[model samples]
Target: MIPDPSAPAPTVRRKPLLAVLLAPLFMALIAVSVINVALTAIGEGLGADSSGLQWVLSGYALAFGVLLVPAGRIGDATGRRRMLIIGIGIFTLGSLLSGLAPNVEVLNISRILQGVGSGLLNPQSVGLIQQHFRGQARARAFAALATTVAVATAVGPVIGGLLIQLLGPELGWRWMFLMNVPIGIAAIIGAFKLIPDDRVRTRTRPDLDPVGAGLLTLAILGIMLPFLERGASVLVWLSLPAGLIVLGLWWAWEQRYKRAGRPPMVDTAIFSQQAFRNGIVIISVYFLGATSIWIIVPLFLQMHLGHTALEASLMGLPSSIAAAFSSQLGGRHVLRLGRKMVIVGFGIAFVGLLCTTILAGFVDAGWVAFWWLAVPLTLMGLSQGLTISPNQTLTLNSVDPRFGGVAGGILQLGQRTGAAVGTAMIPGIIFSLTEGGHSWLEAFTIAMVIIMALTLVAMGVAFADRARETSAPGAL
Candidate 1:
């Protein structure tokens, strides 16, 4: 039977609703995370050098980041479920293409398709939660999402490594991509079955800003491409400046779009909301730290500690599990403590980071003594669990549901931007600092210090954002 078009939006049962909405997101995370572990196999198989391998990763990130706002905006206008199904289909096809790609170059193109699909689908997860749930239910929904993503991030490497070890690199990597086909199909089926039809009646006519969207997309490319490029070249230096220029033009066009009563890619007015601005600062900085450890630690483990991919992945598992638990606890208590939860979450995470950094930097612990790292990582995960859901809840809570898609898109944009920057710069710092007879320990230590600092800044920002205290902490 068809979902009743006239029924209220949140008519579906909550758990099933979340399961359907979050499945694609879970697969997207797995898709990217798994690739990192499989990159070596891919490189050797395709005869790819460093640059080709880098593109395999960067291509997906660039496309995914660039298209997020446009995808979200389109979803908000046309219908989120409609857009999501299309995205899932594209993602599945991308996986098929990736698995089939005989060469590295074709693999890069397939990665872009996967990224685009992710970009299209991710915002809907957040927006739909905002759209369907209210008050305490909303917080719980976000918490569930946070934990699911954390677990997915944590498990991706281990699962990928085992697949490679058991199946052989050539075939294992291909199976990783092929794995998504079944998951994506199931998610599509569940989406049709569980997700309710849009029924809020949009606040305004659906006037999409194609010009603004194009400008925004190009602007992202301008900024992101430079980071993705390696080597010191004139073009490398020019990428950031060129991207900035495009952004300025996009802003100018946005003003015109607003005045003309068209939907700008992101309404400039969203920035005016104090909670939104504060949340942006908090999440972006947090990601700078959060994403860095994930990338750098595995490299450290596999190379410096001389551990296999599976070993490194196992070392990280406790943290993900901790984070999953903490996320639920944070959500359960958010209504009780309100903004203090965010503060406490960051504080806990800060301590965790400090411990992890000291242990890694000073002790120079290796794979044999994995518990030393595991202790701090678990703490860090818990901190993230506490921080992400509450902060996300507070951020989107303030914005009206009409712009929910845009708000979620921008929030995710900030995260992707931070992750991209961390992945590009921090690893480079490790390599650069480690060169010229510097020890890996010293290089990693310095990176850890920098990584710790980002989280510290985020903690400060979260503490400073007192506006959430005054608002309904659990506003419907």
Candidate 2:
């Protein structure tokens, strides 16, 4: 029953294609922020500490970050359809495990499994978009992704909170992970039916470059472990230098591997593209600051102010909604406005964070502060809509379609890595300060300063990139 390789590919309808692609993305993106509202309940249910709860988030992100490049490369070399289906299956299983986990240790492991699954499928989606669409259509498709991200970020807390409220905290939190089961199952079926077979034809076997992948994985693990562990053991610090050394070796090996007429896990040459490089830096830094806001704010509302999970989640609801609409608008204008849109977006986001910090410092009344916070969150959402998708469009515009999977994987790696560090580091700072007798508001204010600083760093990078594009014209 071998199928003809030369048969004309079936026409892919746009809406179905988008639905299937975005569904999995929605699941993964929601996982990133949704759990913030549930962490307290999880800790109370499982008898875990701050560090254990942190691991639940950090472990997922770490596994997600490390697997991204290799999964992207493998998807490109193999069949993306198959890889995507497999990823969803794994993610679904992880969700089930997470729901059923008897203890914190098991929950962390299950979350890592979920991360691995997300890492596998995400690149494939990007590569598929790169392969199937061109020009404005491509921009719109990416906009769809950004919109999905926005909604997921916006609704995750609400959903988590609502579940906790309806079912009670203990049972509510478990359902958050469990809910993905049916959705993931549906996505896998839709993928098989709707996605066109897009395996590249090759005369020779695909080179997966396992050696290079191994080296890169070790390097990433070394670099990220210390940040996640947050000095739980002093020896973890040594891994930083060691990871850097391995990273250098991985780069050198990539050069040698390419010179030997084989594909490397990442084509080192991709980094030479200015737009892609700059986009990586900007997004990574942006995520470092941006992702923490969701985590810290929810925790502050719940733990410090004694707000309910549902109430804490509501704080960011307006922002998420704003982002969703703004993302669509940004997608339409991205090609026309270019990096200027991204720069402006970063500027607005920074202002939002700064303003939020000010309100937290001066306002002592809880309900009143929540109402006041909405304005800044809305501004932040608007900025997010402008920044994320537009930056993605600009960044990947130069990447070769053939390498789109790895390129997208690299792009998301920056995001996930930043998220991991930020989720761990920012909360770690606040928790540490609280332990040291600082008020939650004071600790939160200091963390906001750090987040704002990251936003500024991203803005600076965006400005520099804009300058590069202006000076060289075609440099990006």
lDDT of 2 by residue, 256-353 (tens): 99999988889999999888999999999999989889878877777877777677778787898889888899889888878899999998998899
Stretches of model 2 off by over 4 angstroms after superposition? 1-10, 44-52, 201-204, 365-367, 434-439, 472-476
lDDT of 2 at 467: 92
Candidate 1 lDDT over residue span 1-476, tens digit each: 32322233635787898999888999999998888789889998889999989888888999899988888787777678888888999999999999999999999999999998999999877778887787899889999999988899988988899899899989999999999999999999998888876633555666788889998988899888877776647867687888899999998999888898766778888888877898898898888767888778877877887777787778778999998999999888876776688888878877877787677754464334755788888887888888888888888988878667778999999988888777778988999987767888888878888877888788777766754455644432
- After superposition, the stretches of candidate 1 with alpha carbons farther than 4 Å from their true spots are 1-10, 199-206, 361-368, 467-476
Candidate number with greatest TM-score: 1
Model 2 weakest lDDT span, ten residues long: 1-10
Candidate 1 displacement at residue 4 in angstroms? 15
Taken over the whole model, the C-alpha lDDT of each candidate is 0.83, 0.87
Q: Give Cα distance to truth, residue 136, candidate 2, Å.
A: 1.0
Give candidate 2's TM-score. Answer: 0.93
In model 2, which residue pairs have backbone atoms overlapping below 3 Å?
A: none
